[model samples]
Target: MGEERNRPTIVVVDDAAEVRALVRARLRLSDKLDVVGGAANGAEAVELVRQLRPTLVLLDVSMPVMDGLEALPLILEASPGTRVVMYSGFQEQGLAHRAMALGASAFLEKSMALDDLAEDLLAVLGADAPVAPTSPLETQHPAADDLDRSILREHLERFREVFEDAAIGMATVTLAGQIVRANRTLAALFELSVDDLVGVPFADFTAASATAVRAALADILAGRRRVVKIEHEIAGPAVPLQVRTTLAPVLDSNDRPLYLFLQMEDVTAQRGAEEELRRSEDRFRLLVETVEDYAIFMLSPEGLIESWNAGAQRTKGYTADEIIGQHFRVFYPPELQESQHPEHELVMALRDGHYEEEGWRVRKDGTQFWANVVITTVRNGDGRHVGFAKVTRDVSERRAMLQEREATSAALTAANARLQQVAEDQAHFLAVTAHELRTPVGVLGGTADTLAAHWADLEEDERDELLAGMSSSAGRLRRLLADLLTASRLQSSALQLDLAAVDVGAVVDTSVATAQRTHPGAAIIADTERDLVVQGDGQRLAQIVDNLVSNALAHGVPPVVASARRIGDEIEVAVSDAGPGVQPEMSERLFERFSTGRAAGGTGLGLYIVRQLARAHGGDATYRRPEGSEPGAFVVLLPHSPPNA
Candidate 1:
């Protein structure tokens, strides 16, 4: 009777067998509550409570045969001191009040947690009721007697069942960090059974969170904190689990730390959701902050600036703080703002979801730039417009490049027009040259016929005169044709030279003799240095001297002087005539093709050929007045070394 009185005797009434079993199982969590009997209905509950005379009757409101509201008064009448706790799946305040009026001590919903129901029952039993003694492992205090030992065993069994059947992972770890007891939930977390988890170190399963878990345990053992809760990973065998762990020190009566009570909740899904949200924000921030080519930003629905990114700062030359909250029309040019273009863009974007345009825009420093702008409507999940996402790009450099290309194309067109005029001029010069060839040819033909037909019938002097006339005409014709051939070769770039060592003074004498024979009226004199050797094509050098002498005889007063001398490393050959020098205006262009002066019988190609051949032999040709303003002198200078050198 003493032991039975020490525990609170209770009767459980439920219609379902599973409900009675669950109530019995949960009742085992408290050793102080002893289930005396069970009834399937309220009428049976009243009989059971009266027969046992238990301290409490947990009656379900709904039952077959008789309901709890009808049996409540009978149960209380049979055992006047019994506390009747009415519980149901659904809560009705009116019914609960009626049950209370019928002598029910407490009303509770069946959906309420079993642990809360236990607490409510304990509260109704009061502090004077017998409290279960601490388990033998929990304290060093020995049991006073058999009753105390009996209470200790009951309490230990109750705690053991509660720990082993918990929904979440639970373990009791000694101060040495060894797990002395672990529930099925904790063992299942590591893919092991409860027996296999005991005696294992709890730190082994939390390799990654070892330091944090250890520090938390230390704080609890030191009595600095009652509980430490943290989220960490448990390295299970199959896959790691994200767990929210709570570590609390179970204390003895003297406040000494006994053991650690650990609760681990698998939070992998919860943490994964949080991580996904974090990465999504990070990706959005990275995309907006890293773009440099386009100015990406946001504006309020009313076209006021709202947000700015790195691209907007770099492209618009305005910092985020300076630009945000300002009207977006500040980016438009003065005329565009006056015409309400910014407002128009927003309206179009709102209507069509987007707007794009290219036009002039103003920068922060008041300079204008060409920009490609896009305004995209930003909407909420409900499809209501919230703002505009504006993107702008400066196209000033591209526009300038296109303008420069147009200018270059126009310049090329004008240059082509000038080339066409030059081509026409060349065609007309060829025609005039062809007409000049007939006179010399006709004279030579008539002179040759006269000399041949009347050789014997004519007098000696007459025959000689005809013969001389024929010879002069032939020389005239030869000079005209040679000039034409040389000009042709220069144009074609096919004139070939065979170079050798030669005495340039001898070349000068031969060229002078030929010039004198061709122009009998012009007295030609040779002034040359002896043994003045130079490297050149012998035949080409003679041609050079001959052309200079012929030019002097044709254009200047006699006598024409052909002279050669070695000056420094070069050989200078000068042919001078006593005549007015070249005109100042024509001097610069004297060596150009078709350039000429007074005499016009021969083709105007002599001076041009002279200059080209001289340059090919690594020398130059020039016409200038001698010192003291004497007659014109045509000079040719050749290197003393061989042409190869």
Candidate 2:
């Protein structure tokens, strides 16, 4: 198709080579319009229009030498029929209609889309399009909205003038997330040219920020989060901007969010102030809470209760509702009621800062809790006293517990004294019994040995009877003496440890031989391992082993087992037998003096003496029922010490 003869010829003028290239390419792509030529400055563009005689001149407002604002008249005078379209940047703030009144056909922003540019050019060249008069108002009339729109447009133009010229950052965005306007303030903030920023999406300026653009959009869309006043930090090509955003909602006539008005103020100083205030409050709260033993409360200026915590209720024994607003005098005992002068204290807190005292205060049930009171005045930013903060504590419970513990300790001391007295008495009785019986039993045991030796000289039957009688009498005397002597030593307060290394095998061997002589007819088995050593007095240790073996033979039916072995660093002397095992009652009292196992007849000092001597030597004695013996086992243990010990 042949190009339409009436299509307007357009000339492009700009200082940037890129601007001339873009406009020329975009305008040339149109079938109806032809891009005549291009220039890098207003002077060149003016000469191009005169030489080419194009239908229209697309003039850039900002250029070197002669600016479009200055070249407009010249371009029109050179070609009077040319429809001049003034191209401006986002930062080109002043209204262009005044220039249009001179000769220009229309105004276009440099950031407009290529397609939009084509459409605008076509619309401008259409027949019957409205021509520019010397003024806008003298040309037409419109309804209320358009009239309001015009007035708002004027306001917007004035705002743009200030934004481009002022030394601050600013922008205008619609609720639908569109960049409706911008100025040099925003261009400098984003480190971009005015034309580069005008039509670009707000998100593009903050493309590196993950949620920065989305967050701003949410503030515009969400009704509840409207007017997001954030001290946002945004990074641009040059530097990071620490900006305080005061976002305001500009509502339409229907009270709907239409325009998001954002005013940015740098508040790095205000941030420092808020942080200090927050830290101070945190420290104060920490101090108050750390008063572990005190009940702190806060009251309003009129003395109305504002808060009560666990301590307040515990110390005063009054719930929040019961005594929150009640007069503090309720806690003061009647005696100190007037002397305390709580009202005067409050007045002092209001005038000065704090009032501190220690006294007795009554609880909810009329009992007195010793209290330490501190009431301080809280103040506001203006330094006017706001209210009183009170701290109180109950020391009564602790005092009572301490007294009870002291009483218990005294009772325990008295009981201990009584036990000592009883022990001394028992000791005296045992000592006397042992001394008295020792002499008589020693004589009897000697006589029995003599009679047994001389049995061969008597008649056969008479020898049997004599031996029987002597053995019975001697056994009784020996048991009685042993019991008394052991009991006496058991009650004594003082004891001595003669921890010396002694050969355990030698002791067991000697004890078994002694039992053999003591009970000739009894079957007593003895076995001692070699080199089994222990720490104890040799004499007392021998006595301990002898007692265990004799106990086994007397109580055991027939077979008595005696063995010695090494266990860890100690020596174990075990005596077991196949006899009536120790009963439950016998097992408990079996070691008690004068309480022999049931069915056994003895003074019962043997086990008692053995256990005491074992403990004295830093060892122990134990009885266990052997598996096959049908009787319990008895083990006498002694610890082995160093050879030098």
Q: Write model 2 residue lDDT over 285-382, tens digit each, in one string.
A: 77765555678888777666677766777777878889877667777778666675777778887877888877788888998777778899999889
Model 2 misplaced stretches (Cα beyond 4 Å): 1-479, 493-500, 585-589, 592-601, 627-631, 641-645
Check candidate 2 and list the clashing pairs: 624-633, 625-632
lDDT of 1 by residue, 448-516 (tens): 777678667889998777777767767767777777777778788988878778889999998888777
The number of the candidate with the highest lDDT is: 1
What lDDT does model 1 reach?
Answer: 0.79
- What are the Cα lDDT values of the candidates? 0.79, 0.70
* TM per candidate: 0.38, 0.34
Off by over 4 Å in 1: 1-425, 451-457, 597-601, 625-627, 642-645
Residue 204 in candidate 2, Cα distance off native in Å: 86
RMSD after Cα superposition, model 2: 24.2
